[model samples]
Every structure is written in structure tokens, then in C-alpha cells.
Target: MPKPLPLFTGLSAFPLTPADEAGRVDTDALQALLARIIDGKANSIGLLGSTGVYAYLTREERRRAISAAVEAVSGKLPIIAGIGAIRTDAVQALARDAAEAGADALLLAPVSYTPLTEEEAYQHYATVAATTDLPLCIYNNPSTTHFSFSEDLLARLSKIGTIKAVKMPVAKDLAFAAEITSLREKAKEDFAIGYSGDWHAGSALLAGADAWFSVVGGLLPHPAAALTKAALAGNEAETARIYAMFEPLWVLFRAHGSLRVIYAAANLLGLTKARPPRPILPLPDTLLPEIEKAIAALPER
Candidate 1:
């Protein structure tokens, strides 16, 4: 049998960080979002993640978001805070801020304007790992961060004491079993492996992935958690049934990107009036009907 997973495992919901044009986090709106995720029975909260617009917020705002989430969660679930930044010192400071604000774990992406070498990435993670006792999850999001962690680099970083997990992007072929097995072969024992592509979540979980670092789960946690439960239990029929309900939204996510689609879905659900940060336009009103139709596909429980 597989070794027991650690704290960052399971359906970790990544909520949007509601903020105004000035980038100040709307703490009340954020707390309301958290309430829904907690009520939906998600295993953990991934705050200030890519969905949460961590790269767009000021450090002060990030700290406020963490504190508000900690208060809202109140020990109910683990809070994994995203601390990605272009500069090493900035990431270190953000990691410190996350720890001070009661975050349960740290998620770091190798954010850089210029491409980072594998050695640079490894040292960056090593330095940040030493800065906080909080367990760290490597956020291997090359599309946004412009840096990819090599398997060798990943194996190297996994040996770091505080680096306990990795949030992987989807494999090119979606062959999650081969990918997980390959990564696990060199990773430290109990180093939890999870995937973040919302569309591939069910397949990843069914393939023995330890967690689903989900984007859709942030808003639609009920169905996402339900799908997670079914997949992790190895119930393919039920997983496929629940996954089909998500197919419509997945189509939209593929077409318009999960960030914009989710923002649209949240508004359509009347969950929030806030839009994505400026320069990231909200989906046009024309898509609302389709979004509504997709949301209607879920179980509504």
C-alpha cells in the first residue's frame, strides 16, 4: 500500500482573492468565499494561489488575505499560502509573511522575468525552505512563471526538509500514472504529489495522485470535493459521472482560461461582484448564458 499522505493532500480549494482596483483585498468577500469551501467539505484551502492572484497583490494585501482566511477557517482546515514572486528576497519575505499570518503551508513558484536555470531554481527553493518551518509545496506552473522544474531539480528539492509537496502542471499526454510513478521513484518518501489542471483532476486522483490542487474547487467546491471523493476511492463510474457534469465548464475553461471562466462563473452564481484585476478583463456578458448552462450541469447538492 502507498504511504499515508501528508498535510497538503486531498482536494485543496484555491479561492479568488477579491480585491478592488487599488488592490486592497476585500476581507469580507474573501471570508464569504472561504465559508462556502469549508461548508462544501474541501480538505484544505489554497489561498493566494494563481486563482487568488498572488502575483498581482501587494505584500500587505497578501498578509491581510492570509490573516482573514486564518480567522475564517479557525483551525477547521489547513491553509496553503502562495508566496510566488520574481525576486528571491521577495519570495522569502512573502514566505515569512505567510508563516506569520498563520498559514499552514507555503506554495512557491519560480517567478522570474528572465528564465531561471535549474541550479538557480534549486537554490531558490532551498533558501526559501530554510526561511520558514512551514512545509513548502513546489508550484511548478511554467506557463505563468516562465520556469520549469526539471525532474532532477525536483528530485533535488524534494530532499529539502521543509519541502514536503509539489503542485504539478498536467503532463503533456495526460498520462498521470506514468508521471506520478516517475516522480515518486526519486522523491523522498511521503513527499506528496498533486496536480493543478482542473480538467485533469479526476484522472490524476484516480492514478494515485495524493492531492488535487484544484482551481475549480475554489468556487464550486461541493461538486469538486464530491468528484475528488469518488476518484480517490477508485470508483471510476461515479467519478466519470461527476466528471461529465464538469465537462461543459471544462470546455469553457479550455476556451477562456480557468481564471476568467471562474471569475465569470462566480459572478453568475451571485457569489461575488468583484472582477479579476485590471488588465485581466472579465468575460463578456455574452458568455453568461453558457456559463449558467454549464453550472446547471452539476448535482446542486
Candidate 2:
């Protein structure tokens, strides 16, 4: 029998949306940046993910961004739209707009102001699933969402008819690899486990992650693919070499947030001159030299 397909596998490039100083979406810049990502050979495009600052934008802004992204790619790739919201009704509406805008799939995190019970979380997902037939990827980023998903919760989520994968935030080399195992035991065999710890991607992907839902991939898709390919091929030497090149940027990501660092890197690389959301400011000028040095090390191919 043929092997089953991987969950959101390959390099799912997570793009940082470009906007002007006025905080308006720069459709021209967005289009240019997306074209570069596609040219870089990503398997799919991750639009409006955490890296995109989905939480801070208004509902209408979110919709317009999706429309621009859908139009920009022109169906050249499958756009995985992040529709994470604290309210189910908002998430459902976002899901509708995503579908209408031609997104290939939806990703949601259980973003809540107040604490949520496991049942409440499950119901939120189930309710959103009912809004669209687009396959859902459960985004388990406790760092931003402030809610951690237990294995039991993952198991229940896996059973949702429309849910196909889980974007589990990981710590790179060690614990992330174990999460793939533990999550599998709790979830179904098909529930694809994707990781987003940019620092240790090589070790995690080599260890058996289904997808490298990456920030670096969006910035430098070609080199990121080279690394992921090396890891997938079990070519440890190549993977290690490429990962080392990324070490400096990863250090910055650890110090500041990847969201801010990536925006700065994008600006430095001439990809997006736009800054991140209000509270999440640009990488400090003092850090620019370091970021520039790190970016210079990224292999173009």
C-alpha cells in the first residue's frame, strides 16, 4: 500500500505581513513578499499565522489580508489561513471569510482571556469546524495563546471530523521530539505533528516531525527547504551545517520574539519594510547589526 500523506508536511512558509507606517496592509509589498516565498519552493504558504500577528488585527483587516493573499498566490499554492480568535462566533466568521477568500485550510488556537475548561475548548473547535469544511490544524502555542493543550485534549481534538493536524510549539532538539511520540499515542495515527521551534528545527525534523511550520522558512524559503530536505533525508551533516548558519538569528529570536526579529529581518532583507503590531515593536536598532550578520549567513539556495 502507498504510504499515507504527511500532515501539513514539507516547508509551510509562515509569512510576516507587510504594512505601512499607518498600519494599513501593503498589498503591493505583500504580493512581492509572497511571490518570493513561492519562488523559494515552499510546499505551502502559511498566511496570518502567529508570525503574521493575527491577534492584533481587526476582523475586516484580517479579511482583506486573506483576500490579498489568496489573490497574490493566484492558487499557485495552498494557503493555510490562521483564524485564531478568543470567541467562537468570531472564529466561525473568520472561517467563513477564509473559505470565501479561497484558503486551503484553517488553523486555530484556543485564545482566551479567562481560563477555559477542556470541554469549553473542545466545543470551541467543534463549533468552528461546523463553520467550514476546510481541514483544521490545531495550533498549540502556549507562549502566545496562554492555554496549554493536554494529550487528552489533543486526543479529543483529533476526533473532530475536520481536524487534520496539530501545530505544537516545541523546544527544538529534546522535548519536541518526545511530543511527537506522546501526541501520537493520545491522538490518532494520522494526526500530523508539526513543530515551530526555529532554533532546533534540524534535530526535531530529523527526529520525525511531520511539518516544520517555520518562520525562517518564510524569510529564506530556499535555504530552509535545503535544511528540511537534509533532515528528512537523514543527512545529518548537511542539516547541522545549515542550522548552524541560522544560530545567530535563533539567538535573537530567543532574546526578542521571533515575530519582531522576523519583521526586522524582512526589513533588512528588503522583503518587508513594515513593522510588527503596536505592542510588538521592531527589533531595536542596537540589534540590527547582529541581525544583519545572521541574515548574511543564510544560504540563498
Candidate 3:
């Protein structure tokens, strides 16, 4: 395969898919949300990521979301479509659809249910990489995928020529930092690594992560973009200032039973409707005050 496009750098936000009370994908809400992000000057938009509830969406729904985003964005910023599935065929289909939808790249996670041998995993990515002309960003969220990509596996994947980036979300701060350092040293010059775990965003940038994919970015694009700019510009003082402001929101995301906290935050900012799809409950009425307090405390852009 031809070499993948260079890894996308800078801040990318993963916005959730807002649904209506009838449990349907709300296109108007989605277009409105994308407009908000673009108007906020977000560097890029990553849809169908974990925040978008990709696993729960049907193939058609996923395609609709990508198409809506592509139309709404209208080339204002590159769209990184999340093409994750437990089956290779499903992933390749999603990738092809995303490329046709005009996405700049695809964020692919390993097969979810069965743990594949390293070689199997390699072939899985290679298959999708070959099937789509879009660049690929290997998403490593072992917490959800139940398996981490070993350094050897990553090193080998980097050589595929179509794998241009890795989004490493190792939970441990030190280990995440070390992996970014080592990956930067060993990977090919064009392959960039991104950090997705919000807690380590500041440190990861300092350690040479090319960019960050922020869940918080969906709720507060201005601050997240500011934080990324500050870090990239070597303005540690500004980075720290923005990070301190974002700390509470990050803490809420970490607290148990807080997916709703995130959803609520997004709603409060008018990024999306507060309701998650069925099976995932909305935030309790009691938590609204706490969510509001955190939002109110956020520093102004």
C-alpha cells in the first residue's frame, strides 16, 4: 500500500451523537453541534469515537452520521471517522464508507470480542489499510478493547506504510509518557503518536505526543484548543493555567457513574442533547447542580 497520509496533528474533538427522545439519530442536532464546533474554531472533528457510541450504532446510522458531518463541516476542518468493529469485514466497510464520505482519515480500534494473535491483529489492520485509501490512526484504548498493542506489534504496524499514527490511551501516566517517548524514537519519521487520556494531556504533549484527542474537547473546544496551542508553543505557564481550569471536568469524567456527567456537560454547553441512547441512562436530576457548577467554573475564552 502507498504510505498513509501523515498523522494529523493538533487538537481533535470527539463529539457524541445527540439522539432524540424517540431514540433516533437527530440529524438537526448533529448539524447544529458540528456547526458549534466549527464556529468555536476546533482544529478537527472525530465522530463515531467512543464518545459517539460507535459500537451501538448500526452500519447505516454510522454512515449517516459521517455524511451529515461531512456536509456540515464542508471542508472547514478534516474529519477523522472512527471505524471500529469486532469483525474485519465490518471495519473495512466502515473505512471505505468514511473515505467516500470525504473523511481525512480513519481511527481504527482492534477487534473487540476475541483477542487476536499479534499476527492476526496485524493482518486485520493491514486488510482495512489496503481496502481504503484514507489514512489510518491505530486507536489503542486497552481499557475498552481488553487488549493492548504490544510495542513489537506497534513497531510492526508502523512499517505497514498505511499506518500513520497511534492514539495511545494507556491509563498510567508514567507508562503512557514512556510509550510516547519510545514510540517517537523507534517509529518511522512520518508516524506520529497522539495521547487520548485526558489526565495525562499536558505531560504527554511535553513528552512529544504530536497531538491529543480530547473527550473534554467536545464540551469545551475553546479551552481544549487553547491548552493544546499553549503546550505546542512551549508556553507551559499558559498550559498549566488552562489545565487547572479543566481539571474539575476531567475529575468528573473519572469519577464512577459519570458518563452522564460528560453527557450533561456537553448538553450544558449546547454541544448535544443530554440524552444518551437506550441502555445508557441519562444523568440523574440530582447530578445537574454538580455538573452546572463545574461548567460555570470553567474559565472564559
Candidate 4:
């Protein structure tokens, strides 16, 4: 078996932060969602991710969500809090709040209204990483953040002692193995490399990426965990078998964003009834039947 990657590896399940229309986190509903992740034995709980509506929340509300997660999991699994903001100072303060609220790690994206230069991005990470002792994962999500990390910038950020891992976007043509190898060469020794983009996560893990910072794993962890276990063990046949089960859901995720699909899934699963924060609307009622079929296809416990 391959050695397990430390701290940030494996199935880091990203749960949505259930909240009211006012952006106030519903701690009760939030805790309920976390209970599922804990029961599924996910490796970690990623609170306030993009799927969690981190960008839509106020700092007070974000802190409340982190506090609720810490209370819900009770340390059964690590909590990696997302603290991305458009300003470096805000990110620093958010990092402090996460550490104070008992988060096990931090996830930062270079969120910007004005697109940032590489040096600006590096400095932003460096500054925030300096603010707290908590280990930070660089969130390389260009699709939403509009700021991409060049390999050189990633390598530079990896050298920051507190910046321990990277949550990378899916590679083009699914070239995860080559990208992982090239990234590992320049990154500091044991600096972990993980991928997002749930549909391609099994392939990335099979190709030797350290982790799956997953969106789907949040709502459907049983099969997600199964896929992670098989792929991490280099069991390609088993991984392929389990991954095939998620095909319908992945198609929905691609057609309508994963964020919208997951919110709808959470409601259908009776996990939470919170809608996506506005200007981002819920998936149409027409899609519910397909989502139910997708959910029914997965293993139940």
C-alpha cells in the first residue's frame, strides 16, 4: 500500500455552509451536514469552501460556521477552513479567526477584483501564512478566483513553511500524473499536491496525487470514500468500478455547476434546505428527478 499523505491528504470532504437568506449560518443545519461527513469517515471537513459559499458570507458569519464545524466534528476529523477574501488583511484576520475557532488547517485562494500579478499573489499568501501557526493550503481555483498560480509561484509559495499543500484545479486532458510529477520536483520535499474537480479526482489519485479536495465527497461520501480508498491504494480496477457509479452525478455537475447541484442534493437528501446565496439561484425543479436517481445509485452506508 502507498504511504498515506499527511494532514491534508485523502478525502477532504467540502460541506456546504447552510444558512438563511441573510447569510447567517444555520449552525443546526450546518452541524447536521457535518454529521454525515463524520459518519462517512471522511479524512477531513472542508468548511466554507466555494461550495460552502465562503465568498458570499460576512466574516462574522464565516467564523460562526467554523465554530459550528469544530463543535459538530468534536475533533473526530480535521477541519480545514476556507479564508479567502479579496484583501490580504482580511485573509489574515480570517486566518486568525479560524485558528481561534479551532480549525485544524486553512485554505486560501487569491481572490481579487483586480487581477493580481504573480508577486502580488505570492506576497498575499506569504503575509497570511505569517499571521497564524495553522498550516495553509493554496487554493488554485482559477475558474472562480480568476487568479492562476504559475508553477514558479506555486514553488515559491511551497517554500513558505506554513504553506504546506496546494488544492489544484483539474489539469487539461486530465494530465494529473505529469502535472503532479512536475509540481513535486519544484515543491519542497513532502509538500503535498492535491486536486479539486470531483469528476476527475479518482484519476488524479490513481495517478499518485496526494489528495482529493472534493466537492461531491461532501454530499455523497460513501462511494466517494470508496473511490478514494481504491485509488489511493493504486487499485485502478476497483477505482474505475466505483467511479463509474458517479457518472450521472458528474454529468449534472458539468452541465449545471457542482455548487448548484450539491445544494439541490443536500435538500433532496434531507440534509439541509438552504438555497444557494443570491444571485446564484437553485437548480431547477426539473433536475431533481435526475439528482434523485444519482443519489439512489450510490451505496447507502
Tell me the tens digit of each residue's lDDT in model 1 across 1-301: 4463456778999999988888989999899999999999999999999999999999999999999999999999899999999899999999999999999999998989888889889999999999989999999998898787888789889989999899999987999999899999999887899999998999999999999999989998999999999999999999999999999999999999999998888888887888999999999999999999999898666
Worst 10 residues of 1 by lDDT: 1-10
Stretches of candidate 1 above 4 Å error?
Answer: 1-5
Candidate 3: 10-residue stretch with minimal lDDT = 1-10
Stretches > 4 Å off in candidate 3? 1-7, 21-23, 171-177
CA shift at 238, candidate 4, in angstroms? 0.7
* Full-model lDDT for every candidate: 0.92, 0.84, 0.78, 0.91
Would you estimate the TM-scores of all the predictions? Answer: 0.98, 0.95, 0.93, 0.98
Local error of candidate 2 at residue 122 (angstroms): 0.7
lDDT of 2: 0.84
Over 1-301, each residue of candidate 3 has an lDDT whose tens digit, in order, gives 3322433687888787776655467777788877767766667787888888777787888888899999999989888889999899999899988888788889998856767788889989999999877778899888778778888888889888678888888436366567776776677767878888776687777767777887877666777788888887878898888888877777777873335677887777666664877788877778778788877777546
Candidate 2: segments with Cα more than 4 A from true spot: 1-7, 171-173
Better of 1 and 4 by lDDT: 1
lDDT tens digits, residue span 21-128, model 2: 656788777778788889998878888899877887778878888899999899788889999998899999999999998899998989999988888999999999
Give the clashing pairs for model 1: none
lDDT of 2 at 280: 66
